[model samples]
Target: MIIVIDGLNKHLFGDVLDEVFKLRARVFEGRLGWEVNVVNGRERDQFDDLDPAHVVSIDDEGEVVSCMRLLQTTGPHMLADVFSSILDGEPPLRSTQIWEATRFCVDTSRLGQGRAKNSISYVTSEVMIGSFEYAQKAGVLDAVAVIDPVMNRVLKRSGNAPCDYLGTAKPMGKVTAMAALMDCSDERIASIREFAGIQHDVFLSEADALRLMAQRQEAKSPMPKPSVANQDHKPLSTLERYFVEQMRDARTESEVQDVLRLIESLSDTFTPEQKDALLNTPRAFAQEA
Candidate 1:
């Protein structure tokens, strides 16, 4: 399943990003021989400290297999700081709606090679789907990535090719890099889902995600007490649970408004107890990311 680790929920994921950084060390520093700093066997850079969103794909075993980092283009990003040569002296694109995707890598040794589960092809598409879907929901318009020719071809084959190239490819230390732009649109996201044969939501629900993290921890301890323990504290009906999951994934205020409107429309269909559960979801999600 895919888990999005942003500043809001990073504390809940329990070192999933740390494992992702180790994979990057193996792929970029060990295999690809990039000049990235590998401290304590984890490949990390300055951008990681900026609270960029980490879209992570984990195997059924709850180990991070494929992942990517996303940073708002309005601030410092890879294209502006590290891979500026790809822009050929032009100013990097800076906008609130644009995010730079970097440090994309997969655990080839663990996943092996094939289009089936636990393979590079499968996880690559899964992570792409998560990143695009998450960004689209967050009101992002576009994403930029600095990729090599091999990865460029992979994107083309996976039905997620870049719509535009910012500038000519330039030689990096070990590989040539080109800045490619992709739209965060439904068409783009649908094409990748079709290629990957994914017919359901890629993300795990909040409860399921926390369970996965708990499974991976050595202590296997329960999560911290929720901040809303003083709320209604009533058990949820199936219908109410569905709305809670929907609201959990809703990012923007406008999206939350749409969900609230839908719940209001079904007032006559739900029982009083069920309706109360649904309406009280705001307290459960009072600390929404």
Candidate 2:
């Protein structure tokens, strides 16, 4: 199923966004050899900070299988700010009715090959259908996408090919990139749906999506047993308890250091041993427990 998230409701879908960015890092940076900013294994760019809408496809396991980023062309966008060379010095298209779609990718490595809805091919078309449907509802008239020749062919094969071309293709890292435009209309959406053999609504309820996400996370790694220290010792200080909880949830080295830094900010209150115990004991016991 697909989940459409915008800047306004992003706080309610943190886990979904995490998986989408990680998938982008895997596909665009790790696999495609693209030069992009990847922090903590997540591919993100300046446009992400601009609060663009995201169309994400989730599997039954609640994993994000495919995602596409959407941004309004009235402001700074890929074609206007980054890939302007493709326009050959002509003014970049700027209008509220037109939007820019970039960072379009699918997690093919995990989904593998098939014609099923969960398969890469089906999910790709599904994302396309979701994007067009979403834009049309928001009063967007057309969409301009920065894509490579490979993606252009994929769109053609999926029966959702671009309606027009902008500028000549230019070298972008290992692959050449060009701009393609497509109208946002029910006819285009219907064509993609017919091609993909999907006739039902492609969205999941927010509550159901969160439940599936929780299930996926639990299946990957079960939660550790609670710390016995809380039961044996007296109640902890607010700072110390917060520190220990952060340690329990820390998933990366950077996150661990962030917790340590927070503890250090309260150095006047916590003794060195107290700080050490908060950091070491919880994680060590979590593994053994």
Candidate 3:
């Protein structure tokens, strides 16, 4: 189940926000005992307010399935701040090319659920694609992710690898013990986007990529400059952020759907009756992520 809740600057505070928190508490604290505290039914942390986070995927029935927290190099980040040693002091970020990736997890119950369809790994691929597309949208030239040893293979299969600037990988003496930086290439990034099966292009469309360098140069000028003002820059709000975090703790599709209804309803940007329609609708099933 992957549901991306975008365009929410107008409804940041209200009961809708409260529902997000409730969803977090129900999933993270109630379903999974992963957090140290659950005050007032919201799972929060020091990093939540700082990073530019987004809730990309939710389980079927609208519960969060997998979420990621992305921090740009222009600001303080885990790699540059707490894990500076991991980069060997060169600073992994060189440009608007972002160094991101952290706090990635999927619903526990969904694990091993899709092993049969080859989509068993599809959810993880969606996260990878989302991250890549997000980086491209931000004008990022490079992306770096610190992943557990087992998942490192996943990234590797996706054509990402450790960078020299990323220092050394740590070993925990098990298949999942090591953590390494996964560096993606432009082509690989495109592949990631294509794999996700989304409609949007990342940096360049397939047709654009097929164009010769000279043709690309010719196509560059005389076009209306794209305006970024209409674009969204802020991270998810306190409420929306919590809904994403809850997915890491969701164990069932019903629970996930329960959260989704609240999200759609609370997105009060819709008409009252539209909200009613969203609430009154039956739950939809998502292929196991």
Candidate 4:
């Protein structure tokens, strides 16, 4: 199941939490230099101890895969303290009803090996949708991402608000995009979940569900004039196989929906219920999402 844990409570700050930090350092500092907080192999900063963050997604055996930090609009955030230079003296962030989304990262190593019922991308989408729910419940209005312009466009095209260029979009570094939550409506939240197609706790709209179905159909349809050699023998990747494997073990409709989401991300196709019945069978790894 997609778990949502708020705050660095006592439980989260335990040994598993240490593992999460080490993993973060391994990926962000050791590999990407995306962070400078590592001092002798520990990954942490002031933000680590503060800010009510959300940890979402788990591995095949149930481990954290993806997470995001959110700060209430009432306080100072990275936008004000760290990224102030990027923002031209003043950002729209000061406006009421906006919480900053930061430290958004994924444990790439543990994802897509049938680790969770959903893939990494699927999990992240779920987190975003979950973030919206969190914001709605908390009465927050906007969710900001320190992301690239390209990612900003993707979010906008997928129905997010117009992004403010808080930072430059670099090939190997950070950028910023703030996504506003336009609708706190129950209908809107539900639509987000259904459209994303991931097994999330939030409610979803049927229209969003239908749109996802259409998008999947479009993704699966054959394109014109593709290379013949590339077309004929294109087998499913290891990740694709893993997704199908997860689908086989799904026990509930929500679980099935989660697996279908992973399939949609990979194959870009949504099969009918009749077809799905053929897909859902017992599998070797029966772990939760």
Best of the candidates, lDDT: 2
TM-score of 2: 0.76
Show the lowest summed lDDT stretch of 10 residues, model 1: 221-230
- Cα RMSDs of all predictions? 8.0, 9.4, 16.8, 15.3
Assess every candidate by TM-score: 0.75, 0.76, 0.52, 0.56
Model 3 accuracy (lDDT, Cα): 0.47
Clashing pairs in 2: none
- CA lDDT of every candidate: 0.80, 0.81, 0.47, 0.52
Q: Model 4 off-target regions past 4 Å?
A: 113-116, 153-192, 199-289
Top-scoring candidate (TM-score): 2
Any runs in candidate 1 off by more than 4 Å, and if so which?
218-289
The parts of candidate 3 lying over 4 Å away from their true place are: 1-43, 89-94, 115-120, 158-165, 171-186, 193-289
Residue-by-residue lDDT tens digits, candidate 3, 56-174: 44433333445655666677665666556555556556445665676565655544554321243666666666666656666776666656565666666654445532566654233
- Return whichever of 1 and 2 wins on TM-score: 2
Model 2, 6-98: lDDT tens per residue? 976575466789888999999989999999999999999899999999999988877788999999999899999999999998999999999
Candidate 3 to truth, TM: 0.52
lDDT of 1 by residue, 1-289 (tens): 8989988766445368789889999999899999999999999988888899999998777788889999999989999988887777899999999999999999888887868867789899999999998998889999999999999999999999999999799998889999999999999999998998887888987556645554555234333333352255554444444455456666887667766776777687578756665566554643421
Count of backbone collisions in candidate 3: 7
| Model 2: worst 10 consecutive residues (lDDT sum) | 229-238
Q: Which structure is stronger by lDDT: 1 or 3?
A: 1
